[model samples]
Each structure stands twice: as structure tokens, then as C-alpha cells.
Target: MPRVGGTKNVDVAAVIALRPDLVLANKEESSQRDVERLIEAGLPVFVSFPCTVEESLDYVETLARLLHVDAPPRPAPARRQGELRVCAPIWKDPWMTMDGRTYGSDLLSWLGADNVFSDRARRYPLAADVAGAPAADPGARDTRYPRVTAEEIRARGPALVLLPDEPYRFDETHLEEVRSWGVEAALVSGKDLFWYGVRTAGALERLDRALAPHR
Candidate 1:
């Protein structure tokens, strides 16, 4: 069976054929229409919307209970006394970053890192538009992400720039580009920083190691 990418591209027929006992979904990762379609088909769907580290852990436990499995132990927080100012970009071309309200920012906070753009009004703000100016309505939900310019990032003067390999794959070239801004830069796993799962323990260790040099 082919794996459906997400809610927008979910294969309704395939899902129906599977005759699943329960369906797991995310409020942000899956669309309302898709969830409704599954419900209309008489399938059970559990939707999760976790915005912080603690909430995500709770979601994991909830999911485990639904599956009748033992939940993994909650990961201990990576300890650090002081904050490391960091800038993490999820996209480029127009440049986009996460702000205080996003899960990513919250995860960074848990890791003792502070997002340079955390104070922006939007959870995700465009590098070029910190004010989150109105955009032409596309009938789609406004992306929490916002666009920004490289110059704006330079002005923020982050102590470290974390380049993740997802949403937009930032590689060695991107690493160099960020370093050119006169700040230390490192490539990081986007899933490690942004994803919530049993692997959170590994993610925490990886982040601790990455930030160790900077602290």
C-alpha cells in the first residue's frame, strides 16, 4: 500500500481498505476536511495539537494509551545555566523563522536556547516582515512561519545559527552562508529539534552536544 503523505494528500480509499482500529492525526499536520472525511466514513481519529515540550510529551502518552502500549519515559531536559542566543531558519529564498509561540521555539527554550526572533508577533515570522503584515487571503490558514531577510538576521547578531535539514534542506553551503554573517553556525537535525516522539531523548542529547561548544 502506498503511504499517504499527509491530510491534504490522504488517500481516503486506501485508508478505508486498511480497516484501521484507530487513526492518529495532528491538528497542524492534518487538515480538518480529511479528519471529517475519516469520521464520516465511521473511522475513529484522534487528533493531537501540542504546542510545547510538556504538551508533546502528554500527546505521546495519550497515543500510547490509545494503542494499549507502555508509554516511553519522559526525556529529561538538557541542563544549561545560561541562554545561547540562536537563529534557526526553517526556509530560505525569502527566509522564514519560528517565533515564541511555535513548538520549535518552545523546544529551543527547553534546550536552553533562545530564538533571536522569538519576540516577533507571529509564531513564525518572515525575516523581511517582523510585523506580520496582512497578506492577500488565499483561504488557507496563515502559516505560523514568517519571511525575513538575511540582513535582518545579521542585525540580530545571534551567537549561533542552527541550520536544520528539513522544510528546507540547509547543507554545508548554507552553513557557510550563515557563518558569513560573523556568527558561529552548525547543521542540525530538523526532526531532532522540532519533532516530538520516543526519540526525544536522542534529540535532547544531540542538541546538548551541539550547544556545548557555545555555552
Candidate 2:
């Protein structure tokens, strides 16, 4: 595979130069402008945006069909029963977490873990997401990942706080900080929590095991 560019700012010209059979992108990861540019340049682009584990499996099947390859076996549904209240922060500073509509949230849900911020929506104007500024109309903004305050997190009262090592690279220090909140916390693989497709099954197994002790 050749290096086209970063996820959010793909080099359209470079992609066009390669002239591949098909281009795969994620709606959230890749920029819409780049995808549009590729399409305008007569390149086939398939954009995926799966919000749940089941939808991700569907995306896998769709890709296999598009590439004329056999689809891999799907992972079994979560075997657990009860739900564990969890807060998996993707970033710090202002602190951000995924809502129920996001794939990461659904992934955690599959492992019998409920995201504490599932009902929260990202407020527009960014400032509104942090400082207590007024939020934009819901119809005008994307409302998936919400910026939250530490106080708000404490209010949610998550039983366990999962710290993924990506997007923000939560380390031992961050883990200790989260533990200081007086809740059970653990460091987890960011890819397992965020990435989908072929890794989904393995991610499910790994996360399931990781959450087992807490549950």
C-alpha cells in the first residue's frame, strides 16, 4: 500500500496518481473534501461509517463483495448478561467520550459495558462543549463525541474508567489520575476500542477479557 496522506487530509493527487481499482475511507477519519476530489477525478471511493459492531460486520461483508473476496467469519455475540457502567475517555484536557451512536460506544456495549456519556451529545461552537457557553442548534451540528468536565464525569459515577492509549495516549500517569477519582480504572488498547473490520473479532475478545475482572 502506498502512503496517500493522513486520514483527515488525504493527498487527492497522490491517490489519483496510483489509479487503484477502489479506494476505501471512513467518513469520520477521512475528509469529505478529499473523497469528493477523488470521485471528481474519476476514482471509485467507498466510504464507510459504521456506528455499531453489527454495522461494522456489515461493512466487512460489503467490502468483501466489492473486492470479490470471501468475507471472514463474524464474531459471536457477547456472552455476558449484566452491564457494567464504564467511562472510556478518548482524550483529556477538556475530556471527551463517545456517545451511544458511536462505534466505540457500541463496541463497549457489546462487552456488557455501558458508556457513562452515552446520552450526551457534542455541543457546537466548541466553546460550548467546554466552558458553559451556549450550544448551537442540534440540527446544525454533529453530536457524537461530547467534551466533558471532570466534575461531570464524577457525576456520571462510572464503576470503571477505561483509558485507551490512542487519540490522547493515556499512560500510567493518566491511569493513576483516573484511579484517583476513586473509581476502578485500567489501560486498554485504543485500536481494540476504535478500529473495526478484520480486527473487530479479536478486539471483541480482548476487550471482553479486559472488562471481565471489573464485571
Candidate 3:
């Protein structure tokens, strides 16, 4: 069934009514309170927190083992030419990006692209700084996905910008705007960059093709 909302806002009644034997949750996406509620109601919930690329791969294998299902062959991503300096924004309104510790960033590295903010302290950085201005909340970790500003993006001066399709859809309009800033930009599938396991192989191929123009 189509999940009406995100894991944090899933339909509890609908899920319980389905009478599923096991519930798969994520430490980052699913709330602890929700997991506990499901557990109290006699449901088994398996929570996963796959922050890095390798960890995400491991998470799938672990899940398969738990379910006693045959795991698919592991994906092997071909390495790319480590030349592009990339800035990938996942959201807008208050721009957000994947930092060094995130699965997406790891994927970017695996593809041979260097994330400009990989050394950033937060996994998701709030580019509160605009037009080379200072951040209003430099140390705020209130949300894993931090907010950013356009000026900050310019200041970072990345050679390329990757805009993902989900969490916040970055369409052609967004792509043009990024290009206007004198940086090469493209729309990318969030799943390919963020999802691991069976999807990793395809993601690698897609990313390679997407970045070919800039190479």
C-alpha cells in the first residue's frame, strides 16, 4: 500500500490493521515513540540507521538475513575520475545538503566526485550564510537536514551542483537557476544516490552517466 506520509507520520491505524508480521523502520526516518507504540501492540519492529554508503549495503544484507530471505548479489560501483568538485543540495526554501557523514555524500565519493562540504561538522549543513554572509545558527543540529541560502552556495563556488528529485523535487526550473550561477548543474534521482543494496549498482551507473557531460 502507498504510505500516506513519511515514516514519522505513517498511518498507525492502517499499519496495525494490516497485521504485518514484522515492521521495518529506520532510526533516522522512523520515530522511537512510533516504534515503541508498535512494539507495545505486539508487533516486531526492526530499526536501521545506515548513515554511510557501506553501512547502507550492510543494512540490506542484515535485513535479508533477519527475514531468512536470499540476499541479492552485492553491487559493485565502478570508480570515477576524481576531478569534479560537487555541491549537491537536497532541499530548498532553506537549502540543505548532504555532509561528509551522510549516505548520499558517501555515494558521491564512491562515484569519484568530491563533496565541497565533506569536511563540514554536521552531516547536513545549514547554509544559513548567504552571499558570503555568516550563518545565523552555525551550530544548530535541530534538524539533520540543515537549511542553506543561495549566497552561501555561491560562496562555496562548487564547479558542479547536483539537485535530487525527492525530499524536495528539483525540476528544470531549479536546474536552470543553478546553471545561472555559472555552475554546471543537473537533476538526479535521490534513490540512486541515497539508496543502497540492490539499488546501488544502478545508482552508480546512472550517476556516471549524469556526470559525463561535465567530465
lDDT of each: 0.80, 0.88, 0.77
Which candidate has the top score in lDDT?
Answer: 2
Minimal lDDT window, size 10, model 2: 74-83
Give the range of the ten consecutive residues with the poorest summed lDDT in model 1.
121-130
Give the 10-residue window scoring lowest on summed lDDT in candidate 3.
Answer: 122-131
TM-score sort, best first:
2, 1, 3
lDDT of 3: 0.77
Model 1 Cα lDDT, one tens digit per residue, 4-113: 66666888778877879998888877878888988999999999877777788888898899999999887667555568999999999878888787877887887789
TM-score computed on alpha carbons, candidate 3: 0.85
Candidate 2 lDDT score at position 126: 74
Task: Give the Cα-based TM-score of candidate 2 against the true structure.
Answer: 0.95
Candidate 2 or 1, higher lDDT: 2
TM-scores for all candidates: the values are: 0.88, 0.95, 0.85
Arranged by lDDT with the best first, the candidates are 2, 1, 3
Summarize candidate 2's per-residue lDDT along 37-119 as a digit string, tens digits: 98999999999999889898999999999999998886677646677999989899879998889989998888889898999
Where model 2 places Cα greater than 4 Å from the true spot, the runs are: none
